[model samples]
Target: MIRTLPYRTAAVLAVALAVAALPLTTAPTAHADDRACEQYLHSKKYQIGPRVNQACRTAYDRGKGPNREAICKEMLLKIEVKPSHAASACRLGVKP
Candidate 1:
């Protein structure tokens, strides 16, 4: 039993570490996606098209951060906006 204690503790620690890391690993993807969405929203070319821009703006206004971000990414990707610029366009509003 004494010998097994260290092994059990190690196992528990390993599981805890893995669980903690899961979110961190997945966070970048979401961030990148959201950034892409924002950029698409702000681009002059996309803005020139009132219909397209309005739809995106409406969605962004209505959506929570995650949803807006995802939609932004989706729309930008659909329109072939470059990923690097996408994030800048989808800038988040600062709430008071």
Candidate 2:
């Protein structure tokens, strides 16, 4: 016994399948990821490593540490990182 989809039915199914797969066929916009983090580290002369990359991701995700001075203060007080370096690195771009 042989069965086959009618041409119209098969065409409709093909279109439906294409539509269903459309989303996966395209990529979403990039997020704050590796390149941005690397730039942040390099611009500030920070050691380029996993810890620093994590810090960069955290800094970006937390929108640079609660407030402008928070990460700088935390780093200065707790991590023994210089405030100037912390601020320069954590803040990313908006100068000082």
Candidate 3:
């Protein structure tokens, strides 16, 4: 019974430590993802100022995959860019 108690306590402690460290592990990864998304938007020449920069960043985050054009078009329209311009922006930013 005494030996079993120590083993159980160690198991609980290890689990607690792992749970406590979870956020620390994910925060930097998310921040890095944000930066990478921003850099990609900049490389596409879309972020001309603060307003466009935010929109481009958001578009990149929300629309970086197979449906990127449709997703980005919806988001860009919220900023009042013309439909043609938004479609062109989406088409230009990604490779086929």
- Give all TM-scores, in the order shown: 0.38, 0.44, 0.39
* lDDT of each residue in 41-83, candidate 2, tens digit only: 5776655666555555555654654563454335433544556
Candidate lDDT values, in order: 0.54, 0.57, 0.60
Instruction: Order candidates by lDDT, high to low.
Output: 3, 2, 1
lDDT of 1: 0.54
Candidate 3 lDDT at 2 equals: 83
lDDT string, candidate 1, 1-96, tens digits: 999999999999999999999998877433333224445455545553554464356345644554664565456566676665444554441111
Which candidate has the highest lDDT of all? 3
1 or 3: which has the higher TM-score? 3
Error of 1 at 18 (Å): 59
User: Residue 24 lDDT in model 1?
Assistant: 83
Better of 1 and 3 by lDDT: 3
lDDT (tens digit, per residue) of candidate 3 on 1-96: 989999999999999999999998877433323244335545655555565555444445544666765776677677676677666655544432
**Which runs of model 3 end up more than 4 angstroms from their true locations?**
1-47, 54-63
